[model samples]
Target: MKQGIHPDYHEVVFLDSATGYKFLSGSTKTSSETIEWEDGKTYPLIRVEISCDSHPFYTGKQKFTQADGRVDRFNKKYGFTK
Candidate 1:
């Protein structure tokens, strides 16, 4: 435990830029912006481009390529039919 050597860790609101989604989380990062959270308290605001709410993976909007077996790939590559 050291004194005066650690950055201030506090709760801040992370804003998803694309979706305008907000969430509260603790971080050492600081910001000039502030936001009123659901708890009726004001905290520093941090903007982020991506979050679980807007991300393709978490939102189930991600596109998955068709999985082809080795044999299928080889056959397709060599123009094999039947």
Candidate 2:
């Protein structure tokens, strides 16, 4: 291990704005904002758009798309051989 060459890893709170979920984890990321967590201590707060709590995949509701259909449509329009 090297000394004085690694980023500081500290406990921080990641807040999901969509679901109002907060999770505490160690990260090297920094932020100017802070918030009080459930432990009654203040930690750096980072707001994110998507998290596992609100993500469709984790919730078992992922959207399905037909990739082959779209490719067939493109081929028909451009006369490309498959």
Candidate 3:
């Protein structure tokens, strides 16, 4: 890796807003917010709307909707005929 040419990669905390789940990981993303991790260290805080912790599939709360083709859905929605 070349120096001064690549973005700074450092540890950052990703927060799932819905579930308040947090995990530390490396990223090039930067943020003004900071958070104290479980290790007693501070890291940049990044807030996200959805994560695996709160996602329906991961939580086993996913709904199995009847799969509808695009044409069928469009026609049904607009009442298209002929």
**Model 3 poorest 10 in a row by lDDT:** 63-72
* Candidate 1 global TM-score: 0.72
Score candidate 3 by lDDT. 0.91
Work out the TM-score per prediction.
0.72, 0.74, 0.71
lDDT of each: 0.92, 0.93, 0.91
All candidates: CA RMSD (Å): 4.3, 5.0, 5.5
TM-score of 3: 0.71
How do the residues 1-82 of candidate 3 rate in per-residue lDDT, one tens digit apiece?
Answer: 7889999899999999999999999999989999999999999999999999999989999755545466678888899975
Ranking by lDDT: 2, 1, 3
Residues 14-36, candidate 2: write the lDDT tens digits: 99999999899999997999999
Instruction: Show where candidate 2 strays beyond 4 Å.
Output: 65-82
Please write out the lDDT profile of model 1 over residues 1-82, one tens digit for every residue. 8999999999999999999999999999999999999999999999999999999989999755445577688899999998
In model 2, where is the ten-residue run with the lowest total lDDT?
61-70
List pairs with backbone clashes in candidate 2: none
